[model samples]
Target: MADLETLKARKGAVRRSEIPSNVLTALNRGEIETVNLVEFLAVDHAKLFRSTRSQLSLDDKSAKLIAATIKKLADVGVMQRLADTGQVFHQVLDGSEDREAVYQQLAAHPSDVLRNWAAYMDAANAKLTFAQRLKRAKPFAIDDNMGVREIAWMCVRVPAADKIVSQIEKLHPFAKHKNYLMRRFAIELSRPCGVWTKHITALKERPEIAQPLLEFCREDETKYVQDSVANWLNDASKTRPDFVETLCDRWLSETNSKHTQRIAHRALRTLRKKADA
Candidate 1:
């Protein structure tokens, strides 16, 4: 493993050339996570990816094809490309003789990027129903790596929103998950307006579409999860202030817990801002 202290002490590498060779090597070797967005953006993932294929000994014809595809995407942005890579890999795995063995390794890979691909593979599987896809993403949703946890929901959110009426209800377990990240993932999966992702248009208009999961999470004491629920309402408030104001009022009346109060307070920020303005 690379020296943790060395990585953390980094002044912050915004360009590939600025990265210390050892730290860059460690990152390419998938021995460490990127310290920040700059480091992440500076990484040229093609070499790291090829090394991973070699380490895994995926020498089949399918592997060769994927290798070529990955090479082409070396300079591409990670956000959309990673999801596509995951889907392509899944198609290859689904037809491979060693599907289970290969997939298990990928899902448990040391590289957060590869694990993210694994999350997207499940996300891109059209065969699975929306409910099943959410269930399948649980491990990644709760991944120790923040990057993997984010992708776990980002990749699945579209499918979930397409069937929001049914999908939100099926998320009972995730909304009430033991892990805060997983619970946050459940709410983020339904955010009417998410960061860097398309809005769930229906949710922007019909706040009720997300009520089930929001209700389950409203009392969450975890600030991380609470923030997501609050943000969900905040997003809705942009389009439906009355609904958000009404809900916030009701929540304040129904629960005196500070946690609930915190959520209610945060949820009404937009309205409060408007009133003050």
Candidate 2:
């Protein structure tokens, strides 16, 4: 458990000529806390730090020193890698104190780094807990369009159905952003037998909000939304025959191609069979 003082002291011992002046000063003045060090290494030197083997054009001594510093920081539980992207991947760690501290230090001030780090720390080891991710996702919903996309992708990656439902609920308010997030959610939900019935019921209650998702399912679109709507209709056909028939008829009458019309036709046939039975 390395604290701020320990990190600062260690950083001070490094030769001034070896390290950058600002970085050295940040250490000597105690300005480089553990959070600051973690974020700096994670963002600035992340590729070098995480590499199993080094490729940088530096002497062995400098590379070893830098690598040693990164290992020490990681060993102290200040930073962690959540997943591997083969070449490189995302790392999540704490930030300095708040937005202001980060803004003054990092190049891209007050950006998605904080939100991403927070979410990653919350769920890094505990793959089952989505509480932290959900809470962080809410704030990002109001700002940062890219944050919304990242959070939406996170939801899809989680294995739990309930977490997916919670993600959809959190992101529903942002459906009007026109950023392809809502459509992405709809596509994920449309997978057959992937999510629980309770999740499907929640989506059904917001047809008005979800209407835009239908457009993604058109024949020439080639989006996941298209097959997703078909899957949703198929699922609804099992129990809500009348609702399925009505929705299918509405979709069929629209001026879309026969490919899309075929989906509606299939739903109608299934509904008719269920009605007769």
Candidate 3:
């Protein structure tokens, strides 16, 4: 929600075109000290620069410079401040692979910062090979924060799905994770059609992969997880109406739990309407 003037000011400025860069530059140039940077980012996040770092399409040079600046701050004993501010961490991972190196330096830092950083780092754009990117992102997909875990799955899914042998089979184990978010993450990733992401070109025969996820989620208690499960089924109904109808009809007949029944029924709404017609 950056104001017009603020956005205009950012558009042409080579050093800090994005709000995150503006804040980072101000700290890097001594215009504002670390304390001021923290106040501007973490505590007083007013409406002026509400755009997250990912929204700002920063040029290569600026991203590298900001990565260096973040490293500088960490070296200067203000690493905790960088970890504390969502904006700071957002910029750190905003399409820049260099930020991964910075995170490596702060590997022993708090989980909050690591999880936040893990959420946005796009390994596909990294300088490393595909294997290396997977190596880098694999551990974070199970991060403590649900959002972080979701994001980590996103970073690896496309590339890994296309390249890895038996990728869906390998990922099935995540459904058994203790945290409901990780379980949800596994279900969503196995989706036949991408939600916002590119369609899984490799998963041509979709129903085989989708069935297990639906079964695993049928008994889930977390409302958030159930919602995702419902959405996943809804997405499937568009291409596999028969499969969805059959699954829902079976689940409805077998399960008496209101929550699971509600989700399954909702997912089958389109097919049900078609059947009525």
Candidate 4:
């Protein structure tokens, strides 16, 4: 084992010029404490440090150790303590099996910490290519756990809108997906008035971005699907009040699905209330 002081100095020196091999060697030699190293990485160069792990060519032994080290951090509530949500999120995501368990825990956690952490993770998707991020996020969209699915939708939302230039057209397939959750994912995430997201000014201007999923979800039986459709229309009602009223009126006239009518009524709640007043 190398001197602890020397290891600490080396860990502190991790920068753009830092070599992953040197860090791996230190960890392999048991010179640096895994807990200490992870803490340092989390506090300092979190995103860069996560990238460095891949560059290190993590073998089975090293990967096991790294994953365990990350779990240890979770065990100690290190993620909750961290000021940087991105650092906390990526560190959790870096784990192997423990990653899923932790995500479940975070999803059920109180809204403040977990929700913010999820938002940060979504923002971090900018680092991945459009296809790469979407591929990784697809599974989560339909995950049984509601919290995990919300995070998945969050991940899909920004990259689709911000990273990919053809946001609306590209998202059309999600509307037609066999899974209702996925169809809901498309509607909820891409809403013009999405909360805790960058409002798509384009939706207010074009409004057509929502067309692909709107009518499809209206015909669906799932309450979850109906809610997303209704919520999206409700959001639009805030900005495009007339458009929502007209659309809902048309849907109510055309569709006998009580579910669809229920959604349309809820979506026009504000307008109806105003008209009555």
Number of the predicted model whose TM-score against the real structure is largest: 1
What is the full ranking by lDDT, best candidate first? 1, 4, 3, 2
The C-alpha TM-scores of every prediction are 0.90, 0.37, 0.55, 0.59
Model 2: runs farther than 4 Å from truth? 1-185, 190-201, 204-212, 215-220, 265-277
For residues 37-82, write the lDDT of model 4, one tens digit per residue.
3333333223323433443333556445544544445534433333
How much lDDT does candidate 2 score?
A: 0.42
The deviation in Å at residue 116 for candidate 4 is 11
TM-score sort, best first = 1, 4, 3, 2
TM-score-superior candidate, 1 or 4 = 1
Give the Cα-based TM-score of candidate 1 against the true structure: 0.90
The 10-residue segment of model 3 with minimum total lDDT is: 43-52
Clashes of each: 0, 1, 0, 0
Clashing pairs in 1: none
Clash pairs, candidate 3, are none
Selected candidate, larger lDDT, 1 vs 4: 1
Off by over 4 Å in 4: 1-127, 163-165
- Go through the candidates in order and give each one's C-alpha lDDT: 0.78, 0.42, 0.54, 0.60
lDDT, candidate 4, at 9? 60
